[model samples]
Target: MDGTKALYYGAVALVILIGISVVLSVISAIIGLATAVISGIVTLAVLVGIGYVAYKAGSWLLGDDDSASLDSIGTGSSSTSVDAGSSRQDRLRKQYVEGQISEAEFERRIGDELETEEIDDIDRELERER
Candidate 1:
């Protein structure tokens, strides 16, 4: 009789566990749906904000005023691309000239900078993909 009672109790416990699982699953699904909806709404709001800012900037730039000097707004200087090695050398030269660092220390730092790897394999792979 005790064996039969234990079997009945085990069956009840399994049913209870299944019911709890189903309820928790439903709650989790609701939460997940809510999160997705909230994120989408937030993304849409950010995109709209960006579009509004761009529109305002375009209108402002297109407005004609006789006294507005484009040269005053920008220095209009182009930039040159320098490699890592040359950039390090340039910094060393500047420091030495500025008297902030000694020649010997600048030489040591330049050697260390040039000898180290600036871009690893992963960075190279990403650059290649681009």
Candidate 2:
């Protein structure tokens, strides 16, 4: 599924298609069939060699993680954790919203509970500011 494997597979498929096309073309040719077959075979062999080289190059560029976990992480399957300070802040906010604490007191206490971890851009911390 990664670029390396994709390139390798694509090269292989291209070689196969080209080989088939050359064979068919040779069979339909009006000239010497033997010469055509030889030419076709040589072309096919060269294509296969090129495909192998391309496959090796791709593997060198992309590394050897067949699972491609790094690629998948960006697609929303990764897990994230909230630090203790943030969790405490969430609890405080809930209590403040429910009238368990005054607005002024909530502001002071929440402000004192400094965040200990980096905030992700997707996490709307400004909502907590309100």
Candidate maximizing TM-score: 1
lDDT of each: 0.73, 0.73
Worst 10 residues of 1 by lDDT: 73-82
lDDT of 1 by residue, 13-32 (tens): 99999999999999999999
Per-residue lDDT, model 1, residue 2, is: 95
> Estimated TM-score per prediction?
0.47, 0.27
Q: After TM-score superposition, what is the CA distance of residue 118 in candidate 2 from its true location, in Å?
A: 9.8
Candidate 2 per-residue C-alpha lDDT over 31-128 given as tens digits, one digit per residue, 9 for 90 to 100: 67777889999999999999989997887788754446544544232233344556789999999999999999999887676533334434545533
Error of 1 at 34 (Å): 0.8
